[model samples]
Target chain A: TQLLEQSPQFLSIQEGENLTVYCNSSSVFSSLQWYRQEPGEGPVLLVTVVTGGEVKKLKRLTFQFGDARKDSSLHITAAQPGDTGLYLCAGASEAAGNKLTFGGGTRVLVKP
Target chain B: EPEVTQTPSHQVTQMGQEVILRCVPISNHLYFYWYRQILGQKVEFLVSFYNNEISEKSEIFDDQFSVERPDGSNFTLKIRSTKLEDSAMYFCASSRDSGLQAFFGQGTRLTVV
Candidate 1:
């Protein structure tokens, strides 16, 4: 099974702090997606980076895919209480039937 | 701003009972999927459906679990017999095309006792 390992299983930071979450995998993926899920809610897509070394940004959030396509990262600049949530990284492997294999996730708590 | 929608935000059922979780995918989407996240755990993939048939399923998707697109708009996940381990928040998602990012519904929390 393809597995993605996420770093910093738990994080607590004051408002305005910058944070980065990592997702690493041994297997190469055809595409990778990042999602943020709030309590009692389904995850919402943050970004999808398909190309190696690709970078995409949304406001204070930025996502990057590894050059080998075996890893990804999510960086949040100036995190606010609104940014607190469970952040997950998912990969769609070429051999995994386009099915998404998710990482364990990183729970972020941004205190104001 | 179209988004996937799920019904029965929360469900509570006894063990051995059958339960169905419902979702309404985005009107223009053709690919649908189901995933479950136990509290404090990772989200796990259950199944993916397209063209009215299951395209893929994870090991977690045993005979007890099934998915159906009853019509043009609704997608359903049926658990034939609930187990205590089955209690989790089940999410429904859909994509406009394969290999693209999917939009998810709010999720249906299933509690089996």
Candidate 2:
């Protein structure tokens, strides 16, 4: 079984504060996706990193895939109240039939 | 922007009753999946469907759970004899190919009493 453990299960930061969430696993994955889900809604894809050591930016969010493909991170610069949501990292392994293994989400609360 | 759509935003059923959750994936998507997020828990993969058959399933997908693509456009999940543990937010998603970006529906909140 593949598992992705996310750190800082909950984060409370003031507006303009920087935050980073990490997702790590023991198994290598073919791709890693970052999603943000608001209350009572489905997750929205923020970014997908397919190549090892790849980094993608979306506005103020920066997503990076580890060189070994076994870890990933999401960094938020100058977080705002609008950024508050559940941040999730999902890993997809081809050997696992393209099934996604999601990490425990990081519930971020950016207080304005 | 095309998106996955689900029917019945919320469903309330009693334990031991049956329930069917429906979804319409993106028109061009070939891979479909069902995932559930139990209150306060991580999103868990229930099953993955491709080529008109189940490609993968987790332990949570037991005999009581089944999936079907009754038509070319609609995919459904049926839970026979629902349990309280089944109460969760069920999300339907689809991707053009394996390991690709998946578009998700708003989700159906199932409440089994």
Candidate 3:
């Protein structure tokens, strides 16, 4: 079974603090996507990394895919209260028919 | 901006009863998928549909569960017999093609009593 594990299942930080969430897997992926979900809502796509070692930035959020395409990370710089939510990492692999295999989510709480 | 939409934000059904969850994927998308998330658990892929047939499915998608695109626009998932374990947040998603970004619906929360 292909499994993606995320670290720091829960994070609590004050506003203006920075945090990073990591997703790792033993199997290589064709693409990795980051999503943020609010309570009672479906996940909202934040970014997708297709190439190994690729890096993409969205405002204060920075996402990176590992060189082997088996790991990824999300770094939030100077996070604000609005950044508080459940962040999830999902991977798509050709071996898995390109279906997304999701990792356990990281719940972030940024308090003002 | 286009988005996937699901009907009946919440549904409550008794065990052994049947339930149908509906979804309207983004108008232009060609690939449709179903996923579920048990409380406090990771989101898991259930099935993928394309060109009027199932392309892939997980073990969790047993014969008891089925999907259909009855019309060109609406996709539906049917559970022949629901069990207490079937209660979860069911999300519908779609993508323009394979390996692309898949947009998701708000999701239908199914509660099996």
Interface RMSD of each: 1.1, 0.7, 0.7
**Candidate ranking (TM-score, best to worst):** 3, 2, 1
DockQ score of each predicted structure, in the order shown: 0.77, 0.84, 0.81
DockQ of 2: 0.84
RMSD for all candidates, in order, please.
Answer: 1.1, 0.9, 0.7
TM-score of each: 0.96, 0.97, 0.98
**What fraction of the true Cα-Cα contacts (under 8 Å, chains A to B) does candidate 2 also have?**
0.78
Displacement of residue A101 (Cα, Å) in model 1 is 1.0
In model 1, state the lDDT of residue A19: 98
In candidate 1, stretches whose alpha carbon ends up further than 4 angstroms from where it belongs are none
lDDT of 2 by residue, B1-113 (tens): 89999988999999999999999999999999999999888899999999999999999999999999999999999999999999999999999979879878999999999
- Candidate 2 docking quality: incorrect, acceptable, medium or high: high
Compute the DockQ of candidate 3: 0.81
Residue range B1-113, candidate 3, lDDT tens digits:
99999989999999999999999999999999999999888999999999999999999999999999999999999998899999999999999978679888999999999
Would candidate 3 be rated incorrect, acceptable, medium or high by CAPRI criteria? high
How many pairs collide in each candidate, listed in order? Answer: 0, 0, 0
Ten-residue stretch with the least lDDT total in model 3 chain B: B95-104
